[model samples]
Target: MVKVVQPAYGRVFQDDEGAAELAKVLWKETVAALKEAEAVTLANLARADRYVRAKVEFENLYPTAYQQGPVLKGEEGGEYFNYRWSACEKLNERMLKLEKAMFGEATVKAGREKPAAGKVAADEFLGPDNGIRQ
Candidate 1:
């Protein structure tokens, strides 16, 4: 189940509008949460990319025993960094696919006319897979 975070402005809201107002509040909260998650995921991908590039450079320049195989136990630099690099790469791939689904070019029928690059129509997401109005 998805969870929505408390809105930063929630304290200013009143309870007079009852259920309808509450529903709107919840929807707003959900949108904010989604935006926050997107930002964090993007930032994480950037950090992971930097770490992987640096790891490759370090290995090339030093060519230490830990860099090759059977990294030394309790080592904090090479082995640990490599593990982090692998985990982050996996996460980055998943997030990028999701990002593509959200903001990048969505798949259309091969024979259909394609929209201008970066031009997503309003009704594009109004399908069974996505709840956005297509």
Candidate 2:
């Protein structure tokens, strides 16, 4: 006879034996996966940040503006430009891949009414008050 009101979603789930069982199994696995994904995402972020900082230092020293290939005048002086461009490209690719994986899984999981335990519950979330629509 107990109903756990999901405050944010305005839905409710009965705190019954069946619900408890489902939560025990499904939620555990989902949370574990999310944790692993988060770790990977964090590592990627750190690596990207380090690379960007290094690139900035290289830019200051080399000063791509001084290269005459495109603006100043000759392709030989633009080697630093190529290096910086490629490094930035690689960092961006890594960031995009990590972000996509993290966000895609989260979006799919959000649509389900009964997500596993440790996952964000309706009552636990707060947003613009448009419910999940926002």
Candidate 3:
């Protein structure tokens, strides 16, 4: 996952390309969807592994997106900031609460040639791996 941390100047954008390539190793269906040059972005990649979008969204939204909803709006007005902040926090909460829905087990290996890279499968929680099983 560290390999996927691309600093977006001031903001942090999830590396969908890295994720997709990593997915091709850990995720069963990602390679098929990302087969061609689809401009590997989270939205496009989500077509294959939907949980990826959730995790990516949660990652990009926090600490700085504390950027808009609250980061910028905190000085605007508590009421307005609260609204945006709530929305932002709500998203974060969903990512946390819906960990199972957002992430689960790896179905199977997509194949070889694709190394595990620095990517962690969804099983390891924050590192990746879709869900926490019982």
Candidate 4:
């Protein structure tokens, strides 16, 4: 089982098994999406990194709720609810940014390969013979 750092919600998962399973699923989906976009670069890779982080944080929110059980009449209930809500908000924000970067109007410019030496310029209308033909 993979071990992730305890989220701000604190240690929610009783064991690493659940977290590891979730992480694996997220990783596979992230990789597939990246491949489809042909965005295997370092910069785009960072987007996937953000997604994984956000997902793990979001998943921890569930375990937190489970551990707390029903929310009784107390400020603690409100606080716990607020914290989980904040986590959801943050995860949504990250996902939105990632989607925009992956499929938005932004264009990726690939590096141009230099033409080899001795290549004739296509604009050179005048041929090697140097003059207009009869």
- lDDT-superior candidate, 3 or 4: 4
Using Cα atoms with residue i matched to residue i, what is each candidate's TM-score against the true structure?
0.23, 0.24, 0.30, 0.50
lDDT of 4 by residue, 1-134 (tens): 22222232223333666766676577667767767767666666666667666777677775765555544346555423445555566777887788677556666798887767755466367667545466
TM-score of 1: 0.23
**Strongest candidate by TM-score:** 4
How high is the lDDT of residue 42 in model 4?
64
- Residue 1: error of model 4 in Å? 31
lDDT of 1 at 100: 51
How many clashes in each structure? 2, 4, 12, 0
Question: How far in Å is the alpha carbon of 41 misplaced in model 4?
Answer: 1.3
lDDT of 4: 0.62
Per-residue lDDT of candidate 2, residues 5-99 (tens digit): 21221122243444334434433443345456554355444343333333333444344533523233246655244554454456556545544
Q: What is the C-alpha lDDT of each candidate?
A: 0.44, 0.42, 0.44, 0.62
Residue pairs that clash (backbone atoms under 3 angstroms), model 1: 123-134, 126-134
TM-score winner between candidates 2 and 3 = 3
Candidate 4, residue 3: lDDT: 29
lDDT of 1: 0.44
Model 3 whole-model lDDT (C-alpha atoms)? 0.44
Superposition error at 26 for model 3 (Å): 9.3
